[model samples]
Target: MQQVRAVVAKAKNAPVSIETINVPDPGPGEAVVKVQACGVCHTDLHYREGGINDEFPFLLGHEAAGVVESVGEGVDTVAPGDFVILNWRAVCGRCRACERGESWYCFDTHNAARKMTLEDGTELTPALGIGAFAEKTLVHAGQCTKVDPQASPAAAGLLGCGVMAGIGAAINTGAVGRGKSVAVIGCGGVGNAAIAGSALAGASRVIAVDLDDRKLRLAEKMGATHTVNSRETDPVEEIRRLTGGFGADVVIDAVGRPETYQQAFYARDLAGTVVLVGVPTPDMKLPDIPLIDVFGRGGALKSSWYGDCLPSRDFPMLIDLYRQGRLDLDAFVSERIGLDDIEAAFDRMREGDVLRSVVVL
Candidate 1:
C-alpha cells in the first residue's frame, strides 16, 4: 500500500480536509492511476451534504483524467503508460442488460475490490467508486478508458461526468437532428453542453433558458441561437415564440425541479421529446400535471442517467472530436486549481457562478 494526499470528507456538513490515505496496489482486474486532473462535480457536494448517503469519510472526486501507473495480472484493455479518462460505470458483461446488448444499462458494474483507508485504518468510500482527487487512486481496469493524450486533462476530465451527460441528453436521448428546434432550460455546465450538442447535431434553432444572464452569455458561446432570461420573462412563452408559435422539437430540463420540469413538459411541441438530465432531490416530487396531458403529449419523457453513456464507446470519440476542433471542451474549464483549493471551489459552485473548477494534481 502507498500513502497519498487525498481530499476526505469526514462528516456531513463538515469541511473537507487534505489527509494522508492508504492506496493499495492493484489486485486482480484493478489498476492504479496517477491522477493528472479532476473536475469538481455537484455530486461531490451532494456527498458532502449527506444527500447521497450516510457514508462518512467519503473520498470526493469522480470526474478525472490520468495515466495508468500499474495494472494487475490478466489486464490487457490498457497498459501502464496509457492515458485515460476515468468513468464510474464500469460495465460487467455478464449482466442481463449486457446480454441484451445494452451494456450502458448494465445492472452490475465493477469497482476495485480493495478499499483505500485513512492513516488510522478507517475505510473510505470512494465517491461514485472513483475517488480521484489525489495523487493516485485505485479502480477497476474497466473504469479506465483510453483517450488521446494530446487533450488537456482539465477539459478531458469533464467528459467523465456532467459534460458527457449534457451532450448525450441532446444527441442520444433527445435524438436531436438536423433542422430540429431545441430548447434547454437552466444554462449551467450541463445545460450549456446540451446547447452545444444540439448545435452540433444541426438543430435549426437552439434556445437557452436560464435565470442568470452571465450563464446565458456563456450559453451563447456554447452555440445558443437565442437566450431567454427566465427571471425576466416567462420561459415557456418565450420558447414558443422562438419556435414559430410551436414549442421546440426537443426540450431538455437540465434543472431537475418540479417547476422546471413542468416548464419543459409544456414548452415542447406536441410529439416532441423532453429529456430530464438534471438530478432531483429525494424530497422533491413531480408536481401535479394532468395525467391526460402526459398521455396526450405523444412524446417521450425520459431521465438521463450519466447521459446513458457507454464510456468506452463515447470517451475516445469525444476526445477525438475535441482534438479536431469540432467540440469546444476547453470552454468548460472555468479555472484550474491545486487540490487544496477544492473547498473554495465548492463555495464558487454553491454561488452558481463558476462552471467548473478543476483540481490540477
Candidate 2:
C-alpha cells in the first residue's frame, strides 16, 4: 500500500478536502495508475451532494488520464509506463453481453478487488468505481485503455466520461451519419460533444438548443450549424423550421428532463431517432405523452450508457482523432486546476460557463 493525496467528500453537501489516503497495491487483474489529469465532472458533485447515494467519505473524480505505475499478475492488457485513459466500464469477457459480442453493454464491469482506504482505515467508495482525483489510484487492469502519448492528458481525460458519452450518443446510439439532420437539446459539455460528433459523422445540419446563449455559442464552436435559444423560441418549432419543416432526422435530449425530452420527441421527423444521454434523478418520471404518440413515432428511443462505447476500441480511435486535429478534445477543457481547487471548480460548474475544469496532478 501507498499513501497519496486525494480529493474526498466526507459528508453530504460538504466541501471536498484533500486528504492522504492509502491506495493498495494491485491484486490479481488490478493495476495502479499514477494519475496525470482528471476532469472535475458533475457526477463527482452528485456524489458530494449525496444525490448518488449514502456513499459518504467518497473518493470523487473519474474522467481521467494516467500512466500505469504497476500491475498485478496476469495483467497484460497494459503495463507500467503506458499512458492511458481510465474508464469505469471494464468489460468482463465472460459476461453475456461479451458472449454476444456486445461487450459495450457488458452486464458485469470490473473494478479493483481490494479497496483504497482513509488514514483511519475507513473504506472509500470511489465515484463510478474510479477515484482518479488522487496522485495514484488502484483499478482493474481492463479499466485503462492505452492511448497515444502525444495527446494532452487534460484533453484526453475528458474522453473518459462526458465527452465520450456525448460523442457516442450521436454516432453510436443515434447512428447519425452523412446527410442526416441532427438536433441536440441542452448545449452543455455532453450536448456540444454530440454536435461535434454529428458533424464528424458528416451530418448535413446540426442544430443546438439551449436556454443559455453562452452554451449555444460554445455549441457553435463545437460544430453546430445552427443555434436555437429555447427560452426565446419553441425548440421543436425552430428545429422543424430549420430542418426544411419536417424536423431533424435525429434528435438527442442531452438535458435529461421531461420537457426537453418532449421537445426532442416532437422535434424529430417521423421515424427519427431520439437518444437520451443526460441523467435524471430517480424521482423524475417520464413525461405524460400519449401512447398513440409513442406508437406513431416508429423510430428507436434509446438511452446511452457511457456513450455505448467499448473503451478499448473507442479510446484509442478518439485519441488518434484528437491528435490528428479532427476531434477538438482540447476545446472541452475550460481550465486546468490542481487537487485543492475542486470545491471551487464545482461551484464554477454550476455557473454553466466552464465546459470542464480538469485537475492536473
Candidate 3:
C-alpha cells in the first residue's frame, strides 16, 4: 500500500477536503500512475453536487497526465517511467462494440478493482474511475495512453477530456473537412476547441458564437474567422450573414441548452450537419420545433461522447501537433494550482473566470 495526499468530496454541495489516503498496489490488469498534473473540470463539480450519483466521499479529478509508476501482474501495454495521458474509458475487447471493430464505443470499459481508502479505512469512490487530484492514482492499464514527454503536463492533461471532446466533435462527429464552413455555438473551452479542430481540418470559414466577449476573443486566437456575441445579437442570423446568407455547412451546439441547440439547428445550410457536444441537465427539454423541420433539415443530428475519440490514437497525434506548434493546447491552461485549490477553482469556474485551472502535482 502507498499513502498519498488526495482531494476528497465528502458530501453533496460541499467543498473538497484534502486528506491522506492509502492507495493500494495495482490489481490484475491495473497500473499505478504518479500524477504530474490534472485539470479541474465542470464534471468534477457535478460529481460533488450529486449530479452524477449519491456516492459520497468521492475522489475528484479525471483529466490528467502522468508517469507510470508500476504495473500489476499480466500488464504489458505500458511500464514504469512512461509518460502517459489517463483516459476514463479503458476499452474492453470483449464488448459488443469492440467485437464489431468499433472499440471507441466499447461498453465494458474497465477500471481498477482495488479501492483506495481513507486513513480510517473508508473506501473512496473515484470520479470517472480516475481520482487524479492525488499524488498518485491506480487505474486499468488500458487507461494509460502514451504521449509526447516534451509537452507540459498541464496542457497535455486537458487532452484527456474537454479538449479531446471539442476536437473530436468537429473532426470526428461533425466530419469537418477542408473548405467547409463551420459555426460553433457557445465559445467556451469546448466551443473554442471545435473552432480549432475545424481550422486544423482546413475549414474555410469558422464562426464562433458566445455570450461572453472574452471567450469569443479567445476563440479567434484558436482560429475562429468570425465571432458573434449571442447575448447582443441573434446567433443564427449572425451565422447566416457570415456564411453568405446560406448558413454554415456545419453547426455545432457546444452549450447543450434547448435554446443553443435550437440555434445550432437553424444556423446551418440545407443538408448541413449539426453536432451537440455540450452537456444538458435532466430538467432541460428539447425545443418545440416541427417534426417536418427535422426531416427537412436533410442532415445528421449527432452527439459527441468525449469527441468519439480513441485515446490511444488521438492523444499521441494531438500531442505531436502541440509539439509542432499547430495546436495551442497551452492557451487552454488559464492557471495552475495545487490539490488544495480545487474548491477555489470550482468557484472560478462558476464565475467563468478561467478556461481551465490545472492542478500541477
Q: Model 2: per-residue lDDT, tens digit, 32-69? A: 99999999998999999999999789999999999999
Could you tell me every candidate's TM-score relative to the true structure?
Answer: 0.99, 0.99, 0.99
User: What is the lDDT for 41 in model 2?
Assistant: 90
The residue ranges of model 1 lying beyond 4 angstroms of the native Cα positions read none
Candidate 2 stretches greater than 4 Å from native:
none
**TM-score, predicted candidate 1 vs. hidden true structure:** 0.99
On lDDT, the stronger of 2 and 3 is: 2
lDDT of 1 by residue, 285-305 (tens): 997899999999889999888
Model 3 accuracy (lDDT, Cα): 0.93
Clashing residue pairs found in predicted model 3: none
lDDT (Cα, 0-100) at 273 in candidate 2: 92
Pairs of colliding residues, candidate 2: none
Candidate 3 lDDT trough over 10 residues, lowest sum: 186-195
